[model samples]
Target: MSAPPPADSPRLDLLRFLERVQLQDLQRTRDWIAAEEKHAVLEAARRPAPPPPEWLIEYGIGTGRPAARVHAGSCWDTRRR
Candidate 1:
C-alpha cells in the first residue's frame, strides 16, 4: 500500500479543483436563466391580444324563451340508484 499524502500534497488540490468546477457550473446555470427570461419577454411582446367575443355584445340574459325543466325523479338521477 502507498503512504498517505503529506499536508501540502495534491490531496488539498482536489478541494480547489472541485470548487472551481462548481463555480463554473453555477455561472452556466445563471446564464441559462437570463437567456430564458429574455426569450419569454420577447415572446410575450410579440403575441397579440385576442379580440373580445361577439356574443358578449349581442346576447343578454333572459332574452330567449324559457327552457323546459326535467322532473326531479327522472332516471337521469344517479344519486337515487
Candidate 2:
C-alpha cells in the first residue's frame, strides 16, 4: 500500500498560523492588564492620606478637676458625658 502524505501539509501550516495569531492576541491582553495594575498602584501611592480625626477632652465638674474622659470629635457619648 502507499504511505500517507508528509506531515507538512497546507492544513497543518494554516493551523500553525492561527495558533501564532491567537498567542499574540493573548499576550497583548496580558500586557494591558499588567499596565493597568501598575497605573492603579501608582495612583494610590500618589494620593494623600486623610488627616487625623479631631479629639475631645472632657473635664470633670470642678475648678481644677482632671480630665473625665477623652473622646473623638464624632463620638456619640461625648454629648451625654
Candidate 3:
C-alpha cells in the first residue's frame, strides 16, 4: 500500500472538497428556486383572472327560486336510489 498523506498536511482536504461541492449544489438549487419564483410571478401577471360565475351575474336580481335550489332538488331526487 502507498504511504498515507502526512498528518500535518491537512488530511481533511477531502472533507473540504466535499463541503465545497455541496455548497455549489446548494447555490444551484437556490438559483433554480429564484428562477422558478420569477417565472411564476410573470405567469400570474400575464394570465387574466377568471370571469365571475355565470349564475352569480344571471341570478343577481330577484328570480323565481334561485337556480341553485332548482338544481339541488333535481340532483337530490336523482340520488335517492
Candidate 4:
C-alpha cells in the first residue's frame, strides 16, 4: 500500500513561518498604538489647566447663599452655635 503524505511537507506548511512573523509584527504595532494613545491622552490632560474660581459654567443654575454681608453678633441668631 502507498504511504500517506507527510504532514511536515514544505508546501503544506510554507506559510507557517511567515504567519508567525506577521503575527509578532502585528502585536508589536498594536502595542505601539496603545502606548501612543496613552501618551497622547496624558499629554492632553496635562496641557489643560483647572478653571478659575470666577469661571462659572452657569450664572444662575443652582441656589446660592444670600447676598447679605457679615455683621457683628449675627452668629448668635444662627442655631449652629
Candidate lDDT (C-alpha), each: 0.66, 0.88, 0.65, 0.65
lDDT per residue as tens, model 3, 1-81? 988777655657877788999999999999999999999999999999986433321232355634332233224333211
Among the numbered candidates, top TM-score falls to 2
* Prediction-by-prediction clash tally: 0, 0, 0, 0
Better of 1 and 3 by lDDT: 1
Tell me which of candidates 1 and 2 scores higher on lDDT: 2
Clashes in model 3: which pairs?
Answer: none
By summed lDDT, which 10 consecutive residues of candidate 3 come out lowest? 72-81
lDDT per residue (tens digit) for residues 1-81 in model 1: 988677777867897789999999999999999999999999999999876433222232365834334333323432311
Query: How does candidate 1 score on lDDT?
Result: 0.66
Ten-residue stretch with the least lDDT total in model 2? 72-81
TM-score of predicted structure 4: 0.50
lDDT of 4 by residue, 1-81 (tens): 988658997865877788988999999999999999999999999897855343222223237844333324423332221
Please report how far candidate 2 places residue 57 from its true position, in Å: 17
**Model 3 residue 56 distance off true place after TM-score fit, in angstroms:** 4.6
TM-score of each: 0.53, 0.56, 0.55, 0.50
Q: What are the runs in model 4 whose C-alpha is more than 4 Å off?
A: 1-6, 49-81
Model 3: CA > 4 A from native: 1-11, 56-81
